[model samples]
Target: MADRNPGMDLDLEWVSGVRVNTQAVLKRAQQVQGRKVAKKEWQAAWLLKAATCIDLTTLSGDDTPSNVHRLCMKAMQPIRYDLLQSMGMHDKDITTAAVCVYPSRVADAVKSLKAANSCIPVASVATGFPAGQTPLKTRLEEVRMAVEDGATEIDIVINRTLALTGQWAGLYEEIRQFREACGDAHMKTILAVGELGTFTNVYKASLVSMMAGSDFIKTSTGKESVNATYPVAIVMVRAIRDYYRKTDHKVGFKPAGGIRTAQEALVWLVLMKVELGDQWLTPHLFRLGASSLLGDIERQIYHYVTGRYPAYHELPMA
Candidate 1:
């Protein structure tokens, strides 16, 4: 279904107004010199919460079947097992919810996570992820294959060209088709906000993606020149929150790419907490699409739990 806007003039005016507001926010953010006001409290809370929510690792780039399988096994073993037990809890307590990987390795990830059953979802990046420069049919096929291969969640990239050109209709059509192809699988639409060039575009993309049937709206693919940033995430979350207020349809947010350190992840979590509130903090409403963030959070968790940091080399890599 097409979005219910009163008229073209109103749509254009609304977009233009948002653009003006976006500029003001950006200028204000740039002018601020000192640290963000709630930075400390937000960072501390995120570090603790991130440890429990993170699924620990991601595998990509020249990673073949054997190596990917090996990595999943390692995650299942000493890493997940030890992390859970150390928190004085079971598999249910620790946060790293699911393992994310390339589409080709969906089966391997599913097999590796079988022991946990549905406790952890297998997320696969589809639709020419990172680039998203492909035919709609091809992208839909990718989502279909991933679902067939047992991916519980499909993360597809939005057509950046359409989004940048203001072809909201074309972008919505693509997302609608992808959502249909996904069947029962959850769909996360990556906005690649860095490529969109402005907060207004990011906000519009978020609204359109959700309207088109995205269960979660994501920031980046972690493969672009610009990855996830706090300001960008704040814009997207604000859009989601507003959309929910108007329509009562809740959408989730995932900030992936370049979110490496515990501090960076915490910053995002803090932004979400303040914008979307505590209700959206759970795994269902939030996720960090990170590969190297786990080790950092694990280090923080170790310090908080045991009073000392473990040896750097001793920490496992996902």
Candidate 2:
């Protein structure tokens, strides 16, 4: 995906032409995940790759400084040191792609990572996350503040009202503003796809975000009644592929919220491979926005190597 690059100069015409047949897209989405399984050493390898692409997250109402700090510790080394040693991958750099937190807690995440001497990027959700019902100025400022707080990646929710109402151009300009506000930090535009009304709306929003120069077009904010469904993911990634074909710019894709098992991770890995090709397989261009997903993957890996189930204490804490 790196070779494809992230995005090119905005192309409005290409964005407008992107379309999807709802039934066909949904049919393929059903067929994509879990089509295959990697066992033994291969299973271990897939789990490792999934770990790299995870945006290890903790975006709860109960979030506190200590909770964020502990999450950072996990981000620095998602897999336990002894576990890595057992698989002979101890010396390999094995950390989650990034740590995601709310905008106000960006500084805490940054400080924790720095204190640990880890270069893992802190990603902050901004622009009035879950619902971008605020004014555009306020949302852009949120992105700015997060960037100022040392967030290397900023996940901003798009104005779903614009998308749901068929205001493609409005959505485009707003996301463009969010992208600009991010400056050096990569901007991930969360579509909150489930709220966007239809599959067509989801596809259009994805194109608009990419056209607006989003580094990654995400599926949902995870706060929606629905988030990261297979049909939605397939639609978004296909738009990404179309954008790449027309512009040779490969924007990343992130499916956040509700994905929580090792089998689920493997299914997504398979989806990326089958639909978007192996280039989209790495962390640079693909991310799973999840917290519990990691714990499940870790437990499964531990079982794979040790032939025994890991205890509750063996995993990352609640």
Q: Mind giving the per-residue lDDT tens digits that candidate 2 earns over 116-229?
A: 899999999999897889888888888999999999899999888888877778887788778778887888889998898888778888888887888898998888899999
True-structure lDDT of candidate 1: 0.72
- Expressed as tens digits, the lDDT of each residue in 204-301 for candidate 1 is 88888877878888898888899877678768887788767766777888888887787676666666666788888877788887777777776766
Which model scores highest in TM-score?
2
Lowest summed lDDT across 10 adjacent residues in model 2 is found at 1-10
Clashes of 1: 5
RMSD to truth, every model:
4.6, 1.8
TM-score for each predicted model, relative to the true structure: 0.85, 0.95
For residue 304, model 2's alpha carbon misses the true position, in angstroms, by: 0.8
Q: What local lDDT score does residue 151 receive in model 2, on the 0 to 100 scale? A: 96
